[model samples]
Target: MFFIYRLFLIILLLFTAVTTVFSQGTTKEEKRTLKKARKFLANEKYQLAQANYLKLLTLNSKDVVYNFEGGLSYYFADFEQAKSVPLFESALENSKEDTIPELCYYLARAYHINGDFEKSKEAFTHFKPFIKTSTKSGQELMKQSDYYININDNGKKQLANKNENTIIKNLGTSINSTYGEYAPVMKKNEQVLLFTSRRENGTSKKVDTDLLPYEDIYVAKQVNDNWQLITDKVELEKYIPKDLNTKKHDAGVIYSSDGNTLYTYKNDLIWKSILENGKWSNLVELDKNINSSQYNIPSVNLSKDGNTIYFTTTRKDGFGGKDIYKSSKNEEGKWNVAENLGDKINTKFDEDAPFISDDGKTIYFSSKGHDGIGGYDIYKSELTDNGWGKAENMGIPINSALDDIYLIVDEKEKNGFFASNRDGGIGGIDIYSLCINCPTKIINTINGLLVDNIETPIDGTLTTQLLSSNNPAETTQSKAGKFSFVTATTGKHQITVEAQ
Candidate 1:
């Protein structure tokens, strides 16, 4: 009887310990932190919420609510989406699906950004049945889920056969930071680069509705084949120009062919600044026809002759969210009403960051509605006799399972630049340069199976000698009847096997 009582006490102690580890006490400081975190999350301040939840998670890693909310915080923060997958997984493991019905959708999004399309599809499938189509929000959720599933399928196909011939490389730390850097536009000579960033060094440390720092324009100049940030006060003032960057949001749209006129987006309106006498003039808002009071214009590009302007907007009359529109100047040089690019190039989702080629026959933009892999993918549509051709996705290595926007190619098309939030970047979104039609130097590998005439496994030494003159030969001993060699040159190589 005494042993039984002692055993009960042991069990009770174990239960208490487990509970203590998995849950936080009502301490005033912890309670305050939890309250602040929840408030920030509800208010869509994801970055701040993420910081607070990180503290709570450290204190109680096994709490279901903490894990789920923490997952959402990271998920919506947009930069480190991969960090959400494990937290969502933990939440789902500790709770019932019905109790956390929204978990699957977010988990799928996290998976999609991480390039795990198969898992993402499964999570989306699990989420579909929970959405009730009767309600408007529910119907929207259903549609969003279906959209993700379709794009996930596309992601799987495109990522499996990524473009190997194209070389895409990050622009390095000088041109990027740990914050979001996007919407890159370059001068015709490719000597100067102007991009938008939310880095901490902006004019004012103020945050926008999403709790991210307000956008600011930054400039970098090429030095010895590498980009260097223009940091000298005199150089920065010269390149940035007064009033070009403000405490409020400011972003780069495109640079004119002459590099004298700069089109920009400020507070959802299209504006332009002219470079005269080595200084940029104050921004002038575009014509009323181009700057609609009812919608936001995120991007714009000009015809070579500066007669027509292509811009992106989300007016209610648009095909859906944002769509590309063009406005041509009248005989009096006044802007005319805009015309939508039509169903061929626009969709029910967003289309933004249009860049018209110098020829004005082809335009490149970013879209989320088309047959995309994930997030927003860059696409190009060429104008034909029939109208704009169906936009073609710019395919992998140029576009990843993350937002890739604002692509601009040199007149020769030999090199191009864009921005993406794909993994392995130094920030949420970093500028990247692509070598167009450049030769790819790939190392080829040779593998051989060593076996006796009876087909039994045999130990052997494999030797590989390059056909090129004066190159050293390499040898590898077989391991379990297998041997391999890597060739550095494209030239033919000879392989000889010796049985042991």
Candidate 2:
């Protein structure tokens, strides 16, 4: 009897060892894929990282770490931000206490971004006790979370009171792409439109500090009272001012009030070019007083006379991440040292993309602070006789739960242009035409089969990337030699195949 019991125990141990080996073999591919995903996440390539995580989820959907990381990837991505909610919830349920300390915090943010205020507040409450305010980062997190909580009431009120009278229409795929499009400025006559875009075909085919495509200024003209983009790359080059768009980061800030000079952002500084004889002169950097920061100065606006420049920068000694400052030309025509816009217009969070009204008494800007619903929201403040008035949110349909910025209105405020990354758009951060009181009316998927030289479909794990001259590459993997790629803009595509 003792020998039989010992034999049974030995067989049970041997079977357990065999099962462990099989499990490791099955998960080897997943482990390798997870490493790639982590690398992409570290690089801030959220979309690419989520793709890898999704592949891993297919191998083990119940993985807590995979779901947690996947949630973060979608949360930081350009569009489809609401997809993070389920992923976060799945991970939160299975994680041990404090094992994933910020899980609830991020889940709360996902809920807020998705406009689910009740769940957001609940998740935020659950995460609040874990914050250690002794540390600077923790203090900042606490402040941010408190701000979100306070704004929930106002955000809900604003959503309920959406202004249906206003009509905001997207500029369409011709002017927008999968890459971010923003900082839109139109000529006073509305005959010409200029904006900044990040695309594969941008100045040098190189990425910016964010690892995304570098920004480039693009120009479009109104043909027969209808806006038309220059589809031909050569024609686009002809339309854009010579040497205005460079190999480095460049974007349209604002045109000079008289429209003869163009103010632009280049390499974290402000630059200007004069339009002479239908040509733009070489770029000249702004005075050190205005371009004071070694860090980014992402946006600027000018008073109607163009004497005063209002800009946002991340220079130290500011109110927060990016503060608003103004520099005016002195009597000798040199810009005076910049002065902060003050607490009335700035906050502990980022504030940017200021648009000074023609009257110069009002400024419309985007803010991640204030009582924003979730991400950056458009707000306006009037310069009262006392001082700058309290910032008023523009309300829903114009200010979404996502980023909405770069609002430039005409003299009458009848029509204008802004940019947003809100859902229901054709691409990331599409430019939209704004009509205050008027009416409004609002990707290519590629399928491929991997084949041998003899045109026979090969069955194996294969990676494929769709390359476009005008857009970034889209990647996908297939196990049965079948793959598909969905691109942002309409353009010719080339397939690059790699065997695994």
Candidate 3:
């Protein structure tokens, strides 16, 4: 009986040894396959690499490296929607070490790319702590993931409350093409649409076509609701300085309320130009108070009085990677030093693309820090006498799980334009306009009957115009001394009643 027991133990030991050797051989084979797959990925042969990684997964299903590589390959091959979840899930669930955090981050990113926002949020929450110690890209991905989850929970409604059942029609051939057209900005009147385009024009020199250098800013004017190309008026090509004409990147711009001062981002700095005598003068760097040596200031918003400037900067001492900073003109006309808006407005993520309403009470901006529907969603916060209020998501149909930036609202028209790289776009990014549901209320009005040195109602001889302290150009006339106007915005205005 003792001899039989010893023989059984010896057989069991032999079986265990054989299993160990076999597992080591499989791990070696997987490492080799992963090496080959990584080589293919580096060479841009994503399809081939993906196939090998998928095969390796069958051999060693618990290999975190293999799963992560496979997820990357899937992402690069645009198979993210199909393969990302499994690769990420396998990596997260079966990882041997405490690599679950990194795995969760990747899984969240994959879910985000796959449009599974809720799942992405769950993964992100699991990954947040690890993000602080990970690579820069990992941190950025985590921030983006968190943003999408937040948008899904809080801002989903605002993003979806657009014209219901209206299939988002393409802006048509005039506004769209096989190329890219995006980041549309318009004047207060909504007649002029200034957008960025990568169309084939005379400036289509292939100096550096990898990043699409044939890009140019284009303008289209709406004449009777028909858009007509009007790039000639602005002479966009002429404004491109020799240094800024790099075929790599030269496009984002925002015109001031008066359409004279223009702020644009190019080559990691905000450049300012004035439309003097209908010609663009030399481009100059913005005030140092509004700029930083660390991060680029890509977007800017000016208050109606042009005294307060809000811009995005990646400066150190910021809340996160990027934060919004405000610089205002003091009583002496020099800009006060830049001040952070603090925790209420900024997050430990990127906050950018600010747009203050004409009334100065509502502020619209894009943030990766705030809870958003996706990549970047527009958020609005009201300015109380105390400080900025908690931001509210602009909501869906307006917001998507894609990058949405550069929002401009025409408070008078109850319509606005925003930039998106969402579905139904020409390619890359495109500008979209949708009518907003803006309810107007009547504010108390003070009226005066102008007469020619007599207490009588003047007919056709009295001229009445409304003027505001903030906007000098926003003037509307009322004839015959009987002026009626709706106060859609809240501000101080003077009604001048005079005899002409």
Q: Which candidate ranks first by lDDT, i.e. highest?
A: 1
Stretches of candidate 3 exceeding 4 Å from the true structure: 1-74, 77-111, 118-173, 176-181, 197-215, 223-228, 231-248, 438-500
- The Cα local distance difference test for each model comes to 0.77, 0.74, 0.62
The candidate scoring highest on TM-score is 1
lDDT of 1 by residue, 46-114 (tens): 779988998988787877878988998877664566778889999878874344456677788889988
Residue 242, model 1, lDDT: 73
Tell me the lDDT of candidate 2: 0.74
Candidate 3 whole-model C-alpha lDDT, 0 to 1:
0.62
Better candidate by lDDT, 1 or 2: 1
Higher-ranked by TM-score: 2 or 3: 2
| Cα lDDT tens digits for candidate 2, 1-500 | 00000000111211111211112215668778988898998777887998998898888786778888888887777766677888999887766554455777788888887877777788878767677776666676777678778767667889789887787766655677777888888877548788888877877887755567767788888775456765566565334566666787778657777778878887778888787876777778888898755776778889988789999887777987888999999999999999888888999888989999999999999888888886788999999988899999999888876778888999887679998887655557888987786653324567778888887666333322334443334444442466665444565555656663
Q: Per-residue lDDT tens digits of candidate 3, residues 293-381?
A: 76677667788878888887877778886788889898887779988877767888678778888878888888766666666777888
